[model samples]
Target: MRIFVCIKQVPDTETKIKLMPDGSGIDEGGVKWIMNPYDEFAVEEALKLKQTAGDATVTVISVGPKKRVADALRTAMAMGADDGIVIDCENSLDSFTTAKALAAAIKKEPACDFVFSGKLAIDDNAGSVSQYLAEFLEIPHVTVVSGFEASSGKYVVTREVEGGTKEIFELTGPAVVAANKGLNTPRYASLPGIMKAKKKPLSELNLSDLGLSSSDAKVSFTNFELPPEKPPVKFIDGDPAAQAKELVRLLKDEAKVL
Candidate 1:
């Protein structure tokens, strides 16, 4: 069996984001990049599946600038993926275009038995790529998956839904699964694995190579800006009854919640 895991390079969660001067996008300077945390779960699940299958190969794929995204792919290799492919596109693309590029890249390789990815990327939180990718590939897909098992040539998975319940599915053919947190514990890259990852095969492709272009983007972002700063807190000074009256007055006249 062959498994493919899709990942993204994103600003570290703790990093303080700054907008570009012209409000076109976030400023990339001095930003720390890491693999999307949810994608790590996808990679870990893929590795676990490969280990169980024993004859399976896991390949990592990402779409971004080669310099940065290659690091994410290498991290996956260090975590035991066999090799990786980088779809080298420097500009940020919409979820549609990104999924289209990924599907095209997958088609250029040997037929894969399954595709895995994060439920959503942290940067945009659009949570739509996996669905778009599945549509582009003409395969079944389950998103926000928190459980998985395989038997009788079928995949049994559970996805979290509204009301704290989980929906179960059994897929008998190739499909895409977007992993959520708590599915598995992602392993850290050991020193030896990191060193060995330097030698693993890493291939690159461009948008044109995938029969896509910037014009394919269905959405465009502009006028990026931070949220307005919150106003300072005000204190109501008096005894308990007076305070209550003042609070009610403030809510009704100033805050307007009541």
Candidate 2:
């Protein structure tokens, strides 16, 4: 069995974010980059599945600018993936463009029985890459997969849904699955694994190599803004009845939500 895991490099969640002066994107000077948190779950799940199969191989793939993307691939390789591939995409790519490029890369590479990715990238949070990539590949796709079982050349998946329900799906080989947060605990890259990762094979490709164009971007970002600061909390002090009245008055008059 062969598995391909799609991963991403993103700003550390706790990193203080600042927009560029022209609002084109985030300022990179002081930013610290790390693998996408959800993608970590996907990688761990792939490794787990590979172990279950006993003879499966895992590969990691990613798209981003030059050095940072290579770093993300190294992280995956350190986590026990067999090999890595990075696509060079300097400019911003919308979900559609990214899916197209990834699909092309998968088609060019050796065949894979399964493709895995995170439910969403924390940076963009579009949460549509797996679906779009599956469409491009013409394969079955399942999202928010918290539990997966493979047998008899088919996979049974438990998908997380709204209202805390799980929808079960069974799919054949050559399918895409986006793992949810509770799928598995991600393994930390140890010192030995990190050193071995340095010697692992890594391949890099450009957009032209996939026959894709920047103009293929269906969505473009022109400006960015941080969310407005939250207002200070207010207190209503008085006897219980008086406080209730005051709260009602404030809600109706100031908040206008009564």
Provide the overall lDDT of each model, using Cα atoms, as 2-decimal numbers. Answer: 0.93, 0.90
RMSD of each: 2.2, 1.9
Which ranges of candidate 1 are over 4 A from the true structure? 235-258
Clashing pairs in 2: none
| lDDT per residue (tens digit) for residues 1-258 in model 2 | 889999988899999999999998889898899999999999998998898888998999998896888899999999899999888988548889999989999999878789999999998899999999999999999999899888767889999899999899988778999999998899999999999999999988889999998788998777799899998889789999999999999999989997
Model 2 clash tally? Answer: 0
lDDT tens string, model 1, 1-258?
Answer: 889999999999999999999999999999999999999999999999988788998999999999989999999999989999999987768899999999999988878899999999999989999999999999999999999998656999999999989899999988999999989899999999999999999999999999999789998889998999988889899999999999999999988998
Over the full model, what C-alpha lDDT does candidate 1 score relative to the true structure? Answer: 0.93
- Point out the worst 10-residue segment of candidate 2 by lDDT: 85-94
**Alpha carbon lDDT of residue 108, candidate 2?**
92
